[model samples]
Target: MRGIRNMVLEILETAFIQRALVTGIAVAVICSAVGFFLVLRRHSLFGDALSHMAFGGIAVGLFTNIYPLWTAIVVSVLAALGMTKLRQSTKVPPDATVAVLLSSGLALGIVLVSISGGFSVDLFSFLFGSILLVSPDEVYIIIGLSAGIMAILLLLYRKFMYIAFDEEQAKVSGLQVSKLNYLFIVLASITVIASIRLVGILLISSLIVIPNITAMLFGKGFRKTAIISGAIAVSSVIAGILISYAANIATGGTIVLVLVMIFLAALVAKKAERTKRLAGIKAEA
Candidate 1:
């Protein structure tokens, strides 16, 4: 117990670890909030697609010798907006559009990396995440971006919920569904950019998705589900960081593993509850 407590205190005292905790918690909250709506709209894969698109952006920044985060944000937001426009203006299925963008973005990233000779350490960090290495400036960026995204979400909560539940109905009821979709996709793209430093491009979607679905297993209302999902994400990130620090493992993968474990636990609990309910029904019969 003393050793464990000492370790915890040591981790808390480390500046880099403190920065990582703040950044991770911020990323977790925004991801959960955005992911809840994405799941509701059956657009869970959209986060994955955006992450790939952001990868291309990161590559572009590296190739151009510019800051990758800015490039990533620009590229992701544009790609998301463009994709939304295409979906709105065409008969192409939404998933097909996402697939095309996903493939194109990844291909662009790969080609750029190849042209640049190979993956540099900087690129690799973004690809696999390096939350523990996050600097003070990056932490500020994460917090600022997260706050902006959350504010937008709060302001548009009702409209977003309406469209997520029923886009056609929202449109019919005088809501500008297309515009709202464009805005929502923009938010999601930004969220993906914000998350890359914590979970990396490859595993970002998992951070966005797994917690929300796990929360959903409880069959709660949207607000409660969002809150529970955020709680799960934050806890997993904190635990993952600490465990990875102690175990000397990859932090991004550790966080994702933690999320998966929680999800599996929730699934088991839900199943057991159902089984018990069924048993009670049979007894009554």
Candidate 2:
């Protein structure tokens, strides 16, 4: 135990580890907040779609010798808005719209990489996540964007909740459902961009999804569920980072694996509780 504590202390002292921890915690919070609504609204795949769009944006940035982060944000936000517009204006189903864009965005990214001759190590970092590569400036940008997203979410909490549960009702009640959806999509796109550095494009949706679903098994109300999801996300990130550092594994994958494990545990616990209750009832009968 003492040895483990010493190792943890030593790991914490590393500059890269410190930056990763800070960034991971921030990303976890925003992902939890955004993901809760996404799950409730049955839009969990939206994050996955936006991550692909952001990949295309990153490719564009790299081709133009621009900062990939800014280009990713621009491309993702535009793509999100376009998806929303297309869904609203056309007869395309929402899932179909997502599928079309998901394919197109990924194809665009791959073609760009091929045209550029080859994938660079930097691109791989973004694809698979390299938390240790995060610079201090990027940390500040992530934290700032996360804080802004949280503020907006808090301000419109009830509206978002109302819409998530019943969009048609929200619309009938004069809630401007379309405008709020656009805002939420934009926020989700930004959240995807912000989290790419920590969990990468491929694994980011997992971070945004698994924790919230796990929390749902507890049968809590929205507020408590969000809190529990945030707690799970933050814990998974911190534990994943430390374990990856100690075990010399890929950080993003490690984090996702940890989340999946937690989710499975929750499932088992819920099942066990249900079984016990049923057994008690049968015995009483």
Candidate 3:
């Protein structure tokens, strides 16, 4: 225990470790907040699809020698926007549109990278997350993104909740349902882009899926659920970063694993509660 404390302190003293901690927490908080609403709205798969599209952005960055994060950010936002526009043009489900983007974008990314003589293993960092690779600039980007997203979420919480619970009614009640829907996609894209620098394209789905799922399973109230989801996501990031530090493993994989563990634990606790509730009812009878 003492040795672990000393090691943690040593990591804390390092600038790199500090930046990683900040980036991880910020990304987790923002993504989970948006993710909760997404899960409620049944748009979880859309997040996954957009994340994969970010890979195409990475390929563009490699080909042009532009900053990968910028490339990813612009392309992902556009993809999100495109999905919104595309939805208006057809009767297709959002899932179908997302699948189209994923398959096509991933293929394009692969082809682009191949045409460019293949990107360095550095691309893997974006795919799997590289908390340690977060420079000071990247950290600042995360902070700005986090604050911006949180502000938007705070302003539209009630509207988003109504839309989630009853979109048709929200539209009938004169809510800007289309505008809000577009905002959700855009914000989701931002969350994914912001996260790619920390969690990777592949595992980022954990940040979206795990917290929202766990929150839905256990939490109450829309606002409260979003807050709890953020809390759970942040906890996963901290735990994963520390574990990766100790185990000398990839930070992204470690974080995803930590989330999975938490999910499993939640599952167990929920089952136990159900059993106890059933017993109490039996005794009452």
TM-score against truth, every candidate: 0.98, 0.99, 0.96
Q: Candidate 1's residue-wise lDDT over 146-202, tens digit each?
A: 999999999999999999998999999999888889888888999999999898999
Cα RMSDs, all models: 0.8, 0.7, 1.2
Q: Tens-digit lDDT track for model 3 on 172-238?
A: 9999999998888889888999998778999877788899898777858766777788889999999
Q: What tens-digit string does per-residue lDDT give for candidate 2 at 137-175? A: 998999999999999999999999999999889999999
Using TM-score as the yardstick, the better of models 2 and 3 is: 2
The residue ranges of model 2 lying beyond 4 angstroms of the native Cα positions read none
- Candidate 2: the clashing residue pairs are none
The worst-scoring run of ten residues by lDDT in candidate 1 lies at 176-185
Worst 10 residues of 2 by lDDT: 99-108
Off by over 4 Å in 3: none
